[model samples]
Target: MGEPAPLAVAYDEGAVSPAEIAVGVAGLAPVAFVLPHSPHVRKLRPVLSRLGRVVQLTGRPERDAVLLRRLAPAGVLTFSESLLRVTAGLARTLGLPHHTPEVAEVLTDKYRQRERLAAAGVDTVRCRPVPDVAAWEAALSAVGLPAVVKPVHGQGSRGTFAVHDRADADRVRSRLFDGPEDTWVVEELLRGRPSGPFGDYVSVETATGPDGTEVLAVTGKHPLTPPFRETGQFWPAALPHEDREAVSDLAVRAVTALGVTTGVCHTEVKLTPGGPRIIEVNGRLGGHLNELSRRACGVDLVRVAALLALGAPPPPAPAPPGRVYFQFNGLAPVRPGRLRALTGGDEIRRLEGITGHRPYVRPGDDLPGGVGSVFMDLLTGDAPDHPAMVELLDRALPLLRYEFTDGATTWVESPRRAC
Candidate 1:
C-alpha cells in the first residue's frame, strides 16, 4: 500500500481510472492496465509515470501469448469479457486471477444466463436465444407481445429495442443486417406500473470468496420506463426494505450460479407481479453508477475486486447517505440543427433536488452518433422533489431553442435566395 506495485496491462494513462481508486484502496501499486487491441484501450492509449506498463499485442494468438509473457505482472483486469476467453492461458501463465474464459462467456450470454438461473430454480424472466427472423417470430409467438428483444451478448443500452407490436419490432429492426452472431433473445415481459416507486433498477453489487458472494451494496437504477434504455442511476435504492432484500437475494444467487469471483456488475431486474425478476448480468463495474458509488458510498469497487481477486478481505463499504444521478439530456432530436439557447442549465443546476450532472450534448455541437456506450449504469441519485424536479426540468428544457445561424431572415432565405 506504500507505493504502487509493478502492474501490467494496457490502458490510457492520461485518463482518470479506477486504477487510481484501486491503488488508493489496496495500498498496492497502480495496475498496468493493458490493451491488446485497437478498439480495446485505444482512446486511453497513453500510460506513463511508473503507474503501470502497457503491452501492445499483435492480432495473433501466438503473438499475444508471447507478448504477455514478456510483460508479466502480478494482476490483470479488463472490461472486455472476451479478453478472458482470448487469453486465459496467458493470464494463468502470468499467475493472474483473471476470470476464466468460460466464466466470461456464461455471464455475457443471455441464453446461458436464463438457462442456468431457471435450472437453479431462481426467479428470472423466461429467456431464449433468438438468431433471425424465423427464430425471432417463433420466440415472440411463444413469449407473446410486449416481449423484450435484445442482443444475446450485448451490453447495457446497446442493440436493445422493445417490440410493443409487430410495427415497433419492424421499425427498429428494418435496417439490421446479419453480422457477428447477430442473434437475440425473447423474454417474458414482466409488467411494472409506469408510475410505481419500484420502477428503478436495483443492481446487486457484491464480491465473492471461498464460501460465496458478499452483498456489498444495492445501487438503484434511476431512469424508469423502457425500450429498456437508461438515462441515469443512484445508490440506496428508493425501494422499501422488503423489496430491497428480495432483489439482493436474487443477485447473490445469480452471481454465485454464474461463477463471478469479483468486480462490480450491473445486474438487471424488473419488479414484477410475482417479485424481482432478473433480466441479465455482466462481469464488470457499473458505469456511471460505480463512480457515484465511490463518491457516495465510499466503497471503491476496483479495490474490492482486487482484494477478492488477490484473496484478501474487502474493505468496509462506505455508508454516506450520498445520492448520485446521471445528468440526462432532455429528449431532443438525433440530427444537428441550430439550438436557440440553454435555458435550463442554470435553473436545473440551481434546483434543490439536483446532485451532479455530465451533459453529453451542448447547444451548438452535433450529438454523437445519436447515442452510444453504457454497459451497466445504475447510479441515479435521489429525486425527493419529484413534482418540483419535473416542473423545473420542464421549464429548464425548453428554455433553450434552436434556429439557423443566419437568423430568422436566413431560414426563409434558404432556396428563396432573396435575403
Candidate 2:
C-alpha cells in the first residue's frame, strides 16, 4: 500500500480534554496536532508528543490555516466547537471535510436541530425559543409542562434544566435567557433512562459519507440516571441479543434522520421495552467515552474520523471481547470554596482497573463554572467486568476535592453519595 495520509487533530486545552488518549502505534498514519494554549499542558503534552504540534491563535493572520498548512495533514480533526467554527470556512476552502459550520450551528441549537429533524419526521422534542414571559407562557402551552428549558445552543449539558412547573420554568428561563427576545428552546422533554429500560443504550460512533453513513461500532451504555449526565459508560455492554440489534438500527436511522456526511456523531438513545427513543444527537465524538472505547475495544475513532474527513477509508473496526469493562470514574460534585486541597489522589494512581485519571481543578484553584458532575473523563479501563470496574472507580472518588467560595453559591449534581 502507498503511504497513508498524515492527520491533524484538534487538541483541546479545556475540560474533558482528549489529552488522555494513548498512542499505541504509528501504524495508521503519522499524526499532527493543533493545540490551544492550555492550563493542563504539563499533563496534556505527553499524550501528543508523538504527533507534530501546531500552535493556534498565535496572532498570525489565518493562524490556524497557516498551522494546518505547515502540518500539511492529509485530513483535519478538531475537538473544540470553537476551533471548528472558527476554522471551518478555511478548512472547507481547502476541501478539508468536517461537520459543516452550518451543521455545527444547527447541531449547537436544539431549536435549530429540531427544525431539521422535524422536517425529516424524526420524533424529537418540539422546540421553540422562550425569552420572556409571553414567549415562555406560549412555549409551555406548545411544549407542555415538564419541558426541557436549556440554552438553545449549549455544551457540556451546562445550563440544562428539566422544567416541570411554571415556577421552575419561569425562574430558569428568567435566569438563562434573561432578556426581551433573547432565544432559548422549550422542548417536550424526552425522558428515557439510557441503560436501565433497555438493559443497554446505543450511541452511533461513526462517520458519514455522501452515499450513506458508516456505523463504526454500536457500543452499549451501562445503566445511568435520567439524562445520564454523570454515569460512566461500559463498553460491549452486558446487553441481550435483540437490544443490541435495536441500538444499531436506531443509530443508523438517527444518522439518516440528521442528513449528515463525513462527520463524527454521538447520538444518545434509550431502548425502552416499548421501543427506541433518541435523546439527542451530537455532531462530535462522544467525549472521553470515545477514548475509553478506544482503550477497551481498540478502535481509533479519532483516526477514522480524520481519514473520513479526507474521504479516506477508515481502518477496519475493532472486534469486541477485546475488553469487557470500560467505565468513567462516574461524576462527582465538588464541595464549594477555593480548592483548599485535594486528598486521596494517590488512590487514582493505585487503582487496578483505572486506566486513565484527569483532574480539571486543583488546589488553590477557584470553581468558576456552573455545576455538573462530569467535567471530563477522569478514569478509563478494562476491568474484569462492569461491577468490578465500578468498584475500583468508586475508590478514587474521595481522593479528589474542590474548594471555592466567593460568598456566591454553586451547586453540584452528582449522585447523592458523590457529594
TM-score against truth, every candidate:
0.78, 0.78
Clash count per candidate: 21, 10
lDDT of 2 by residue, 336-392 (tens): 455444454566667676666666556566554443444522555666765565565
Among these predicted structures, which one has the highest lDDT?
2
Residues forming the 10-long window of minimal summed lDDT in candidate 2:
410-419
Clashes of 1: 21
What TM-score does prediction 2 earn? 0.78
